[model samples]
Target chain A: MKSLLKKELSFYLNNPLGYIVIILFAVFANFMFVKDIFVVGSASMRPFFDILPWLLMIFIPALTMRMISEEKRTNTMEVLLSLPVSETQIVVSKFIAVWILTLIGFVLTLGLPISMYVLTGQVGGRIYLPEVFVGYLGELLLAASFIAISLFYSSLTKNQILAFLASVITIFFLIIFSTDFVAGVLPPVLQSVLNYLSPIVQLSNFVKGVIDIRSIFYFLSFTALFLFLTVVDLERRN
Target chain B: MITVKNVTKQFGKTQAVNDVSFTAQKGEIIGFLGPNGAGKTTTMRLILGLIRPTQGEVLVNRLDPLAHRMETLQHIGYLPENNPLYGEMKVREYLSFVAEIKGVSNEEDVSTVIGQVDISEKAQAKIEELSRGYRQRVGLAAALLGNPHILILDEPTSGLDPIEQEKIKNLIKKTAKNKIIIFSTHILSEVEDIATRLVIVSRGTVVYDGDKPKRKGGVEKLFKKLVV
Candidate 1:
């Protein structure tokens, strides 16, 4: 499992296109924060957390677009399955790789929040430590969910483009299901269920700087469900 | 040694392999011969524990392939059909990764197989940069890592030139002296040249299983009769 993880990390770190995409994600992250700073006329993490779900819908899929799909396309999935590695090991290694890449990109945006506190300390701008911590917690949970979702889609098809598009569209629907317009289209009871299913709604709880056990379960269950689906789907092809 | 006892696999309603039973002892090159889609690869996948046998059992080295998957996997080396490789990785780099995945991390195994496959010169080249023949060699080199007890090569030379075909056949001959090799090939001449035994399957059933031909073109005659 460690070897697989190392191999995956090497693929991302060494590939020119892979590293370039990661760098580009960071650049856009900082850019998002800077633009938000101007628009809001204040230094807070609300905008960053707000745009994260959208960023993740695109970025996580790009990170995992080839996870299982490429192996199937190249027929290397057979070779991998024939090895001594377990299915859990392979899936976990890939999930960890995507998580590592996402976290690195998320970390790059740290400079903005820190510099906001530092540069604007003269103007009474304060960085709420607890909110920043919870926001980061939300980021990790959302990333976990998105990465798992992408891996599941990747396992379903050999085409990376199809995997990317499918996961993006699924996540887009999940995000919008929490909105007022979409909620209005459903019955009151169904709307509540949709809001509970929405990652954005769960993320909103974290950005508000509160730790809700229900939200934690929601993120974890969402991640676990998809990861399990990925393993089972790949197993069927075997 | 591998024992496949009345193994049958079905994908939905279609029986990919039906009641297939065979034993591959150590040092035997058992060639699985059939036309395309004739369950050769399916049986190989069964032996490798890639899929479950719906109606029977497959044992690798006395252990069930599924129950003792990782252990059995350690004992067998598989070169899947099409020989998929990480196109971005250098030959040596890819071999090293295989070595790690197979629990053979030492540089010695990597270098030894690189030399054995005659890819020492191309070790630094990316897999996509190599010729078809060389890419096949790299695939063979990876299979050779850790000196596994059993080898499963699924159509190892299907798309190669005559020269490349000869090279793989010779490589198999050299390596099969002590290790068990179960390879699938439609080319009867290649089978006659390399395999010690023949197991011919047609439409998911093994019609013939016996020793290497005692006479010239004998396996061909037998294969033709059984395949159709």
Candidate 2:
């Protein structure tokens, strides 16, 4: 497992994709900070959180789209599978690599809140550190769940583009149904069911600094379920 | 040593390998020959535990491959059909990475195999930048990294030029003195050159398994008579 992790990290660092993801996230987060906090003078980062899921909806797939799909396409999956590693170990290594990359992005966003703190301190006000910290935690969990889903989808196809598109559509629908759009269109019973399935609803509660156990469990279970499915899919292909 | 007992693999309604059974002793170089889609690769995948057979068992070094996958695989090395590699990785880097995963402590093995395959000059080159023959050489070096007891290669010389093909054939023949080597190919000349024993499968069943022919007609005549 350690060897697999080392190989993945080296591969990502040697290639340009990892740096591109970091740069893109940094730019987008800075733009959101300028537009939402500076121009609008909003105390809440609702705009940032609103765009966070969308950015991740596209970015996480870009990170994970090639994890297993490229291996199958190039026929290198057989070489790896034939090595002295179990199917679960391979899945865990790839998932952990992408999850660590997402975590790095979360850590980099700390600059936003720190910059906000500096601006507010000059005016004799305090920055709401707790709320922002909770929001970061929430985003981390959300990104992990999306990475799991993308990894599983990647294992299903040899085409990375198809995997990326499928992940975006699936995550987009999950985000849309979490909003008031579901209640506006569906009956109450169906609306409640769809809302339960929406990650956006769960993520919103985190953005508000409420660490609900149910929401945490939702993200954890979502990650575990997809990882289990990825293991099964790879085993079948082998 | 390896043993296979009544191993069968089915894909939905089709049986890709049907109740196939064979045993290979230590230090034997066997050739697996078949047409396209004849289950040669499938059977090799089964032996390496990359895929589980639908029924029966595969034992490598006296342990079931499914149950003891890691331990069993530690004794074997495999190169799949087409020799897929990470294109962005340099040849030396890729070889070192595979060696780490296979638990080769001695870094000298990497350089030794690179020299043996005559690709030491191209060690720093990326896989994508190499020609087809050089890429295949890199793949062979990877399989030879850990000094495994068993080597399984699927079409090791499919796309090489004629001179490169002869070099690979000679390499495999020279390396098979102490290890059990099994390779699958459609080319009759390859089997004739290096195979001590031959196993031919057609439509998922073994049609022939015996010693290499001593006469002059070559495997093409024998395969035509058996597969026809």
Candidate 3:
């Protein structure tokens, strides 16, 4: 299991994809955060927190789209499955590799928050550290769920582009479920049910410094469910 | 010993393998010969438990391969058809990774297998940069790690020059003692040179399984007569 994880990490670190994703993430995320800081005039990270899901929707899929698809495309999945490894191990290793890479991208963007802190200190504005920490945790959980979903899609097909598109479409629905457009179209009871399932609603609680255990459980369980599905799909190899 | 009994693999509407049965004991090299889409690779996959048999069973050392996958895999080393590899990784790095998976992470084992396959010179090069012959060598070297009891190679010499083919044949010959080696190939001369036993499949069914014919004209005449 360790060897498989190491090999997955090597593919990420050695190839240009890992660095490219991180670099684009840092640049685009910071750019949007900075743009919102001057307009909001309170050094708040609300805009950053709001834009994070969209950023991850694109980037996480890009990172995970090739995780299983490339192995199938090149027929290396045969070699991988023939090893003394189980389908669960392969799925977990791929999940951990993408999670770690997302964590690295998070670390690089720490400078954005630190800069906000220093600017707020000099200008006599208020910024809550607790809320920022909670918001970052929320984003990490969201990214984990996205990674799992993207990996499931990747395992379904041998084409990376198809995987990427499927993941993006799925995440788009998850994000929009809590919006007014979706709410207006649904009956009130169904709206409440969809709201509970919407990632946006769950993520909003974290961004507000609520620290609700239900949201955390929701994210974790969603991640686990998709990973389990990926393992089952891979085991159904023809 | 490797035993494939009445194995059939059906993919959707297509039957890739049909009621095939064969057994090879230790110290025997079985050359699996068949034309394109003849189910050679599918049979090998069944033995490796990459795909389950539709209506039959595959056993490695008297245990069901699907039920005892890790144990059977530990005893078997397979070089799949087309020799798929991580093209971006260095040969040595790739082998080391495979060694770690095989529970033989010792550097000495990796180095020894590299030497055995005569690919020591290209060990530092990326797999994509090596020629077809060297890539096949790296695959063979990976299979040789952990000193597996059964070696299943699918078309190990499908596309190589005469000299490279001879080298691979020699490597198989040198490693054939006390191990069940089953390799598939289109080259009749390869079976004539190294195979002690022969199994030929046509259209997903085994048509012949017996001792390699020692008479003049060798496997060529027999294959022509039996395959079609």
Candidate 4:
């Protein structure tokens, strides 16, 4: 499993296009977040966390769209399956690779939050660093779920473009299902269910500096569910 | 020994393999011959545990490949059809990755196979940069890693020139002394040249499984009689 993970990581890290996309995501996301900091006149992390899911909807799918699809296209999946590695290990290794790439982008945006926190303190403005850290944790969990979701799509199709588009559409719906306009039109019971299912809703608590265990559980379970589905899809191919 | 007993594999409505059975013992080179889409690759996949048999079992050294995947896979090295490889990777890098994946981290095995296949000069080149013959050799070198007991090569010499074909055939002959080598090919002459046993399939069912034909007609006549 370690070797498989190493190979997956090497593919993601060594590919020039993959590396550039990751850097572009970090720069663009941080650029958006910094723009918000100046326009909103506060060091609050709400804008960063709020816009993160949108960024991830595009970025994570880009990272994952080629995970299994390329293997299938190149017919290397046959060679990989012939190895001693299990379907679950292959899926998990790919999930971790995309997850790590997403985290790298997240880490690059750290300078903005830290500099803001320190600058705010020096200027006698109030900014809680722990709140930003908790928000980071939530965003990471959300990114993990998105990575798993996109990987599941990647496993379903050989066309990377189709995988990316499918992931983007699915994630778009998940994000919008939490909105007031969408939920307000639904019955209260269904609205509550959609809210529970919505990653944006789960992330709201974290962005508010609340370390909600239920939200954490929701994200972890969501990630695990999609990863399990991906493994099932791969095994079905075998 | 590899035993595929009454195996049938179906993909949705299409039956790719139908009640086919064959066994290959060590030190035997089984030339698996059939027309296109005649379940040759499917059967090879079944033995490698890449896919499961729908109706029966495949045993590698008396253990079910699906149940003992790691054990069976460790005993078998497969060069799949088309000889699929990570084309962007250098030959050495690709073999090293395969070695690591197969739990054989010994760099000596990599160098040895590179020399064995006479791809030492192209070892530093990316796999995509090599010709089909060199790519096939790299694939063979990967299969030879860890000294697997069984070698399943599907059309390993396809698309190569006559000289490259002879070289590959010779390598297969040289490597078949102790390993159970089952290679699928369309070339009738190749079977007559190197195979000790022959297994022919037509439309997903085995038509012949016995010694290579040796009477007035060679494999060409026998293959036409059974498969054509």
List, residue by residue over B37-85, the lDDT tens digit for candidate 3. Answer: 9999999988888888888888899998878888999988899988999
Query: What ranges in model 2 sit over 4 Å off?
Result: none
Question: Which model, 2 or 3, shows the larger lDDT?
Answer: 3
Best lDDT among the predictions, by candidate number: 3
> What is the C-alpha local distance difference test score of each model?
0.89, 0.87, 0.92, 0.90
How would you encode candidate 2's per-residue C-alpha lDDT over B1-228 as one tens digit per residue?
888889899988989999898889877889999899899999998898777889988999999887788998988888888888989889998898889888885779989999989998999999999999999999999998888999999999998889999999999998897899999987788899899999999989888888888876568888998886
* Per-residue C-alpha lDDT of model 4 across residues B1-228, encoded as one tens digit per residue: 999999999998999999999899989999999999999999998988778788998899999987888888998889999999998888999999999989989999899999999999998999989999899999999999999999999999999999999999999998887899999999889889989999999999999999997853489998888877
Query: What's model 4's interface RMSD, roughly to a tenth of an angstrom?
Result: 1.7
Q: List each candidate's DockQ score.
A: 0.69, 0.64, 0.78, 0.72
User: How would you order the candidates by DockQ, starting with the best?
Assistant: 3, 4, 1, 2
- The CA lDDT at B189 in model 4 is 92
In the order shown, what is each candidate's alpha-carbon RMSD? 1.9, 2.1, 1.3, 1.5
lDDT of 1 by residue, A1-238 (tens): 8889988888998888678777888888778778768879766888888887888889899999998999988888888888888888999999999899988888888887788778778688687879888998998999999999999999999999999999999999999989999977999999998888899999898998998889999999999999999888876733
Sorted by lDDT, highest first, which candidate order results? 3, 4, 1, 2
- Full candidate order by TM-score, most accurate first: 3, 4, 1, 2
Worst 10 residues of 3 chain A by lDDT: A35-44
TM-score for chain B of each model, two decimals: 0.98, 0.97, 0.98, 0.97
lDDT of 1 by residue, B1-228 (tens): 899999899998999999999898887999889999889999998888888889888888899988898899998889988888888888888998899999899999899998888888998999999998999999899888989999999989988999989988999999997889999987999999888999999999989898977799988888877766
Candidate with more favorable, higher lDDT: 3 or 4: 3
